[model samples]
Target: MTSRTAQNGGHYGAIVVGGGQAGLSASFHLSRAGIDHLVVEKKTAMHKWRDERWDAFCLVTPNWQCQLPGHPYDGDDPNGFMVKHEILGYLDRFKAKVKPPILEHTAVTAVERHAAGFRVETSAGSFTADAVILATSLYGTPSTPRAAERLPDDILQLHTVDYRSAEALPPGAVMVVGSGQSGAQIAEDLHLAGRKVHLATGNAPRCARFYRGREVVDWLWDIGQYNITIADDGMGKKRHDTNHYLTGRDGGRDIDLRRFAQDGMALYGRVKGVSGGRMLFEADLTSNLDAADRVYNGINALIDRHIAEKGIEAPPPSVYVPLWEPAEEPAELDLAAAGITSVIWATGFRPDWSFVGLPIFDGTGYPVQRRGVTAVPGLYVLGLPWLWTWGSGRFLGVAADAEHVVEHLTAAVAAPRQLMAQAG
Candidate 1:
C-alpha cells in the first residue's frame, strides 16, 4: 500500500466507491474482466456489518442467500440465520479470496463529471476513471424524523446505527420508534434485556420465519418472490415498497406485533410529533396491527396456493391466534412520567449521495437508474433497493447486479480502445 500523499491524482480505468459487498462484488467482476480498477473505501471492508449493526443483529435472510461473486455458502446450515460476526467473517473471507484493489480509509469527497468519465476527489487523493460505480449501499445515512430535534437535550437519543446493546443506553424505559425490522428487533432486544420498552408501530408487513416446515425465505425463493422486477406491474411496485418485518431471532422464529404486545411491550401508533416534552402519536395502533396480520395471511395464502399447484408435500399450515388483547391506543406519551430516559430511532436510512456531484438523483434523493445504469454515461449505482428485482439490494442478489453494471462499464471502457485499434 502506498502512502495517501503519494497516491495523489492517480488514474485508473474504473473506480468503485465503497468497499462493502456491492463494491467488492463489482471489483471481482472487473478484475475477472481484466479491467484496471481501484476500490476506495472510507472505512474497512464490510464496515457496517462490523460497526453499525447491533450486537444481536443477524441476517434476516438465511445462510444460503449469502452469495457473493465466486463465493457461496456451502455449509450445512443453509436454513440457519447468520449472526453479525458470521456475516463479517464471510465478507472478510470473500475479500481475501477476491483481493480487490481497495484503498482503505480513502473517503470520496466529491465526484464530478470529467470529460466523458469522472473525477473522484477523496481524502487520500484525486483519481480519474473512465467509469465510476457508486456501490455505497443505499442505506448509508440514518434518517430521523424532524420531531427528534425538539426532544430535550438531556434525553439520550440515538439512531439504530449508534445502538449496540441495551447496556449502552441509560437505565429507564426505552421508546423505540419505527416498527420496521430494525425497530421491531431492537424493541425485542430491549424488552428481553429487562428494559420497559415502548414501540411505535407502523404498517410494515409481518411474515412467519417458517411456513409449512420450510424457512419462509426458502418458500419465497421457490415461489420466485425475489425475482419480482419493477416492470412487472403495480403489484410489483407495491411489493417493493412494503418492508418485511420478520425476525431472525431465536434461531429464526416468527415475529408478529401480537407477540410484542403479549411480551408486555407497550405498542403505540406512529409517532406524530413532540411538543412540551410529550410525544404525540396517531391512534392507528390497531389498524397497523390488523394490516400486518392481513399481510401475513396473504403470504400464507400464496404459499398454500403454490404448494397445491406444484403438489409439493409440506407440513400442514399452523393456525396462529393473537396472543394479546387489544388495548386503547395512547394518543400521546409522557416521557418523564413513563420513566423513559432514552429513545432509539430505528427509522431506517437513506442514501448519502452528497459526494456525487451529479443530477442523477430523484426527488427523494435516490439515484434514478435502470438496473444500476444511469443516464449519465460511465456513472452507475449498485446495491440499491428495487434496482432491478426485489432482491437487488440483498446479499443474495447484489453480486448479480454488480456484474450487470460492470459488464456495461467494461464494454464502454473497451469501446474506445477498439476504435483506436481499428483506426490504427
Candidate 2:
C-alpha cells in the first residue's frame, strides 16, 4: 500500500488505525465496497513483522494458512512454514495487491467522537470519518515484569523483541525467563548455538508438531477446530490462554522442554524475584513441565478421537513420554555464580488501548465487541485473539472477520442514506 499525506484528509467513509495484516484486510473489504476510507499506520505496513521479530523467527503455522483476503497462498511450499523474510514478502505482495490508501509513519494519538462521526488525531494531522476500525492487534505493548528492575545494573538484559542471535550476546551463560512460544523457541536457538542457557519456565501449553501421519494442525483443521467460534465454544476464554508452544524453525518440530533438559539445558521454575544478583524461583519446576506435556498429549488425544470417530486410515496414535525430569526444584540462582552475563525476557505483551476514547473496553482493558462490531455504532475492533473464531488473529481467519465486520459497517452506512432519500 502506498503512503498518502494525511494533511489533505477532509472526511472519509471510514478510518482504520493500524497497517498490519488486520488493518490491511479491513482496507481490502472497504475498498471492495467502494468505501472511501483511509488506513493510518504508526509506521510502515510491515513494521511489526520486520522490526520486532528476531532474525531466525518463522511462522509457527504452515504457509497455507497465510491466506489474506482475495490472496490465498500460491506458494510451492504450502505445508512448509515461512521464515521471517518469506513471511514479509508474502505480506508485501498482499499490500501491492490491495493497494489500500494508507498513510505510513503516522501515529494515531486519539480517536474520539466528532460531529462528522469520529475524529482521529494522528501525529501527522487530523481526519474525520463516519466510522473507525481499530485494527491494531492485541499485543501492542511489550510486558516485562517489575522484577526485572531488581537485577544488578551491570547485567545485560533484553526482551524477545531485541534479541537477535546467540552471537550477539556477551560471552557467558544466558538466563531466559518465561517459557511461552518466544521463550521456548529462543532458548532452543541459543541451545543449538552451543550456548549455556538457563530457562525459567512458565505454564504455557504445548502441542505435537506432527501426529498420526500428518501435521497436527492439518488434523485440527480437518476436525473443525479452527471453525470453532468464541461464542459457540465452551472454552471461549481460550483467547487469553497462553499459546501452545511449538516451532516452525527448520521445518516444523515439537518443542519439548523435557528434551531440552535432557540435552543439558538448565531448567528452573517460574521466576519469583530478582535481588542481590540472585534470581529466586518457585519450587514447581516439575509440575510446570508436566503441565505443558499434559496439554501436548491432550491435543494428541483430541486428534486420535477425531480419527477413530471418522474411521480415517492413519498411523497408530501414540503418546508422549518425558525424556527428563528435574531432580530438584532449585529455589534461587546467583547470576554471578552461574556466570550468566545476559538475560532474555520473553514474558509476551499486553494490549495498548489508551488512545481509544470510547467506553468499549471490559475490565481487563480488552475491547468488548461482538466479532469486531462494537456496541458503539460506527466504531469497531478487529485482529484481537478470539474476536470470533480461534483463527481470528491469524491470517487463517482475519479475512473472514474483516468481511463480516465490513458487511455490518456497509449496512450501517447505507441505512441513513436510504432514510434521507425516502424523506426527500
Best by TM-score: 2
The residue ranges of model 2 lying beyond 4 angstroms of the native Cα positions read none
- Range of the 10 consecutive residues with the lowest summed lDDT in candidate 2: 1-10
**Local accuracy of candidate 2 as per-residue lDDT tens digits, 51-132:** 9888899999999998899999878999999999888889999999999899998889999999848999998878899899
Judge candidate 2 against the unseen true structure and give its global Cα lDDT, from 0 to 1: 0.91
Q: Would you estimate the TM-scores of all the predictions?
A: 0.95, 0.98
Query: Which regions of candidate 1 fall more than 4 Å away from where they truly are?
Result: 1-6, 235-242, 318-321
Residue 216 error, candidate 1, Å: 1.3
- In model 1, what is the error at residue 186, expressed in angstroms? 0.7
